[model samples]
Target: MTRQDISELYRGYIDCLNRQAWPELGRFVHQEAQYNGQRIGLSGYREMLENDFRAIPDLRFVIDLLIADPPHIAARLCFDCTPVGELFGLPVNGKRVSFTENVFYEIRDGRIAQVFSVIDKEAVRAQLGNDSP
Candidate 1:
């Protein structure tokens, strides 16, 4: 996997996410892709995306920085969206929030096989206000 290829894959993946096109996500991930440390098959991944989009209609990923090496890439993605429904059990209706995450990905055969992400959960909770711990 070359850096350019990985970068392009990520770009398309982000595009799919932005468009909420869960089916297109299959083009970039393995059959057994994982998210949030959970082992999710491609169908499960699609379900998760659908659920997220249902909850956050305006969800998007802003690519602030991307550092790549063959077979791996680390990204600093700026996330922004408004909750149109409940998230983490918080009934925050249309509340806009912004946060960032550091995501490290490992690619195999030009597909993202694994990933690790660190989200600003505390900030998310703070944005959640009374729902926050």
Candidate 2:
């Protein structure tokens, strides 16, 4: 697929996530997708997202940046929400925080086959009144 097509596909995937469209997720994600270094298939991946939404009711993914290179896509997703309890092992406890997650995805057969994500835990910690290490 062309870069534009891949980027469009990714945007649709993000939209699906934002809408919590679990049934339509298979259109964008491979059934045997892997996240980080773990091979957590589609069901596990969906469960993870569901848990995230449960923890942060206002959770929404805003794309701050997106770059597509054929089979690879790099994205910076911005989040501004309050978690019910803790986030990233920090006691957020409904305190509003803003952070960015840098993520990379590998596409195969027009679907996301793998993902590597890094959240800005330090940013969240500082926002929650913790000292930067």
Q: Best candidate, TM-score-wise? A: 2
Candidate 2 whole-model C-alpha lDDT, 0 to 1: 0.94
**Model 1 poorest ten-residue lDDT run:** 124-133
Residue 33, model 1: Cα distance from true site in angstroms? 1.1
Tens-place lDDT per residue, model 1, 73-96, is 899999788978666666668888
User: Candidate 2 at 45: error in angstroms?
Assistant: 0.5
Candidate 2 lDDT over residue span 8-78, tens digit each: 99999999999999999899999999999899988999999999999999999999999999999999999
Provide the lDDT at 15 for model 2.
98
What's the lDDT for candidate 1? 0.81
**Candidate 2 wrong stretches, greater than 4 Å:** none
lDDT of each: 0.81, 0.94
**Estimated TM-score for each candidate:** 0.86, 0.97
RMSD of each: 1.9, 1.0
